[model samples]
Target: MSEIVFRSRFDNGRRKAFERSPKVSLTSPDFYFSHCFGVCRKKTSMGPPGIIWVASRVTQPDKLSEERFCEWYEGQHIDEVTALSGVPAAARYEAVPMSELAGPPTAETIKAAEQRPDYLMGGKWLTIYEMKDVDFRHTAEFKSLDGQSKPKGNLLDEIFTKAHFETRFGALLSNDDKGIKKGPGKLIISATMTPGSRASAEDIEQFYEREHVAEIAKCPGYVRTRRFRWVDTTVLKEFERLPADPIEPGNSVVALHEFEGPYFPMEGLLKADETPWTARVLESLKKNGIEAGFYRLKRVYGEWLPGSSKL
Candidate 1:
């Protein structure tokens, strides 16, 4: 029998190893997607090429002050990070205060956002960057041509000191919004968790790919769901040349949902569904481990500019 093979629609009859995540083509049959009966999807889409996610959270140090920090970040920091060859785009988000978050909130999620532990990256602030298929570790700006440490010069000086910050990098596993618009929407649901020690990561990924995501689509105005695994820093000798001590990644996978209009992302999540599927899913995540939150999106720059009252 002739061998049956699977490959992307973009494949030129050659199978190249995917660098981080598999390259899914536009015409693949098993595309990740869903539909909300009431919310119609716009006829626009902006997707990443083998998207790698880089998320960092931070806090304002005692002396730097919020105003100075904003001026510095808005004036320069955002540009520097986005300019890196691999990075396609960058955006900053301020965690909505626990009181303002939607539906019934999870206490642990609220606490984690407030505490901003080393593992959680930073307190109150999250900077998300979308990286293309390129390996950031090998970039000229990140490392020397001969494989040596390369300083970001004064840009490095401006960061790390002004606030407490850390990050986690990973590839796109599955996204309901794979072909959806990459707009700066008004709300986001960011949930992070590690799988049970006994269960392989693939098992968790497959479960979501097959079930949970579709169930969550029932939530009103749901736009998309993007899942990510912690980038294993040790893979490419990248950690050796880096400055920050990448804390051990605990919450290995993060599921982010984007929503717009008047609906809340957690309206469905916070309420326990009395079904075998969702109940088991939640039970499994808990026994395995989970940390999550509902955040109202706060845009930091551009046309959505704010006065001194904003962050």
Candidate 2:
């Protein structure tokens, strides 16, 4: 199993509330959550929250009106898609006011329809987030795809979706964006490579050097990437009672890269039809013989509001 921490880079007030009093019951209304990692039986540190909820009206790029897009999105119920993908934690959806949304949202201009009383009352942008958990990475499942079950989607598709997710609410974290906590916009992207052929310690070291990992700093949004030697135990028990059910302990090297600044700016480029640049970066890694799947993460938090139930 793998675990990660997720957080938002916007709203210092909310982030403070989450950290100061973090923990929410699964039954809470304002705190809807979900996780790709597995079941979250208990809570952990409530670090802080971020604006990560994202939905795109232009999946195919027909350029529909904001009203038409909203209607279409509601009809599709993409939330159900998120839930069905084996969410390990509970998550909720929030509609942020246009003023609160990170980026400039076109949705704000649409007036509420005559019958939609509830629609006009809230903000134009929406936010969805998962509940807090300490051991999120440990619950995620990473399976090998056989030649038969290879992924059907192209790399551009995957990166675009993620970029959109990270960037949609990223505007709030911008240097000029107000109410951002000092450390609000920090983020990490982790990559776990399942070697096509088992690699030795020397091989790993050589790969990193050969792949020019030292040059990651050259990238525009590049922060820092660290390589882990793969700790076999998920938890340490008194240095005597070893953890019983740890995830795969062999043949994997974990690389963690930290990104500071905005949520994910890569999506903006992708959305604007800049696949070549994105592809070039990805291809560069492949050229260096480095193959790994990248997963981005943030920290979610729960601020125990007065009258909020605890589990």
Candidate 3:
């Protein structure tokens, strides 16, 4: 569980509120709300979390227009997806642009010193859907989501930027819930990897779960994380996609690292418990190292809103 401590009065109120809301009552234990990560929850009590992301873009400049993209997402797409059996929770986020990546280390720009040009093939505005297993993408509900099960209005899909409307899958590897009030950060720093010729995917995955995450938690603003692979997609239908779609390649690796930050310092991570394995891991991926991006919170909406929305 998250290290979210509340005053006795507040806790009692939250419990009472949870008891009152039918949705909250039915979703308790499965959906634990937190501020650090907007409306996040584990897919299962003891299993890997299935992570999928969708990207969208802005259309106009008013509340109805500016947030229409998000509204369609939160109100329609997210609601439909999370309503599935065994599917406990879901969340959405906006990718923080380079303009906001100010201060010491990030001031230089996350991609300015681009060593791997082809890796950060993600979107600026993204939403993540978490489920009980990677196979949830293959469920009857998801089949509808894939445009293979059923169809009707599909209004939300109409507002999205087709090109930016990319999707990717990830298998939960490590999560550190001990850091702060919620997740470790106010921001999510991602590094999607492409294995090099000499790199062993098996070895890197094992090291990441066993050693890398624990070491990363030592960083100053570090929090929790959810790591997944492109292979974690639907077991049945292969998604039809544009040629430029990143996930279409089916050979990407993602690690969404959360941090309590105005920024996640590269030096901070390097300085945190610099074991010999850290250097080895770095050296291993040198051929095609981490292609990173920082995603910030845009707006969060769920059935438990106005109450646990701030939770």
Q: What does candidate 3's lDDT look like per residue over 1-311, in tens digits?
A: 00001101113455466457554331233332221112223345444555565555443333226455555556665666667663445556666655444454464565574453454534556666565665555433544452332123543234422223445555555554556546225677777665553355666677777887777777777666566666432211111223322332235567777777676555766664387765666566635455676777654434321111122
Q: Write the per-residue lDDT of candidate 2 for residues 92-149, one digit (tens) a residue.
A: 2233332322334344523322234321322222323232222222232211111001
Best by lDDT: 3
Residue 292, candidate 1: how far off, in angstroms? 1.8
lDDT of 2: 0.30
**What are the per-residue Cα lDDT tens digits for candidate 1 across 79-149?**
55555555546556666655345544577666755654333322455555565542343333533211122
- lDDT of each prediction vs. the true structure? 0.45, 0.30, 0.49
> Which stretches of candidate 2 lie above 4 Å from their native place?
1-185, 199-202, 233-247, 263-311
Q: Give me candidate 2's TM-score against the actual structure.
A: 0.27
Q: Which stretches of candidate 1 lie over 4 Å from their true place?
A: 1-61, 103-122, 144-159, 178-182, 198-202, 233-251, 272-275, 281-288, 300-311
Ranking by TM-score: 3, 1, 2
Better of 1 and 2 by TM-score: 1
